[model samples]
Target: MALRVRVAPSKVVLQNLITCLILFYFVYYVSLSMCCLILQVYELDVLAPFDFKTNPSWLNTNYKVLLFSTEVTYFVCGLLFALVVEEWVWDYAISVTILHVAITSTVMLEFPLTSHWWAALGAGLISMICGGQTLAYCLFKDNFIYPDLGNF
Candidate 1:
C-alpha cells in the first residue's frame, strides 16, 4: 500500500491563509456590530467576544442575547470562510479558531477556564467547520461527486 500527499507551494498556501484570516475577522466584527445594533445591546463591550468572564449569564436577558448573537456571528464567519477559501478548508478554519483562542487568552491575561466559555468556543469552532465544509461541499459538488474521466 502507498500513501500519496499533495503539497501546495508555500506562497500560495500562505496567501490563502492570509486571505481566510482577514475575511473571517472582517466578517465576524461586522456581524457583531450588526448584532449589537439589531439586538439593541449597545452596552455590550467590544471585548465581549474575547472576555471569558462574559459568558452567557442566563439570568441576565440582555447578556444572554448578546452571547447568543456572538455565536451566530461565528457560524456566519465560517460560512464566509467556505465561500472564499478553496483548498484545505478544514485546516484554515481550525487555524483561525486556534489563533482566535490564542489572541483571546493573550488579551485577557489568562486562559478561559469556565465551561460555558469553552462550550461557546467549541460550539463556534464546530459551527465554523461544519458550516464551512457543508457549504464547500455544496459549492464544489461536481468535483466531489463526479470523477474526472479525462484523466483516466
Candidate 2:
C-alpha cells in the first residue's frame, strides 16, 4: 500500500521552500568557510609546524581566492535578501551577527583572563536570546501552528 500526503497551501509551500533555500545557503557558506580554513589557510601555512602543515598546493591558491570572493558575495546577497525580501531573514542575520561577535572575541582572546571570557560569554548570551526570537519568528507561529499565550 502506498501512503498519501496532503498538499500544503501554495503560500505555506512557498514559505517552506524559501526557508529551505535559506538553510541550504547557510550550509554552503559554512562548508566553504571550513574548506578555506582547513585546506587553504591552515594546511598551506608555511610557517606552521611540520605536523600542522599539509602542504596543500593543488588548486589551493585559486580555490582560496574564489572562496574568499564567493563568501563575501554570499554574505552581501544574504543581507540583501533579508533586507528586501524576507523580514525573518533580518532577525536571523542579527542573531548570526551576535554569534560572529562571540566567536571573534573568543578567537581573539588567547590569554586566560576572566574578563576576556566574560566578554565572550556576554556575546553568547545575547546571541542565545536573539536566536530564540528568530526561531519563534521563523518556525513557531510563521510556518507551524502553535499557541500565542502572551509575549515570550
Writing each residue's lDDT as its tens digit, candidate 2 over 1-152 gives: 99998777776546644663565346445544566565555433321111112223446553443334334433443444433334445444444444444544565543234443344335533543354445445544555445698997
Clash counts for the predictions, in order: 0, 0
Output the number of the TM-score-best candidate: 1
Q: What is the lDDT of residue 140 in candidate 1?
A: 77
Cα miss at 74, model 2 (Å)? 4.3
lDDT (Cα) of model 1: 0.74
True-vs-predicted CA distance for residue 121, candidate 1, Å: 1.2
Checking candidate 2 for backbone clashes, the offending pairs are: none
TM per candidate comes to: 0.78, 0.28
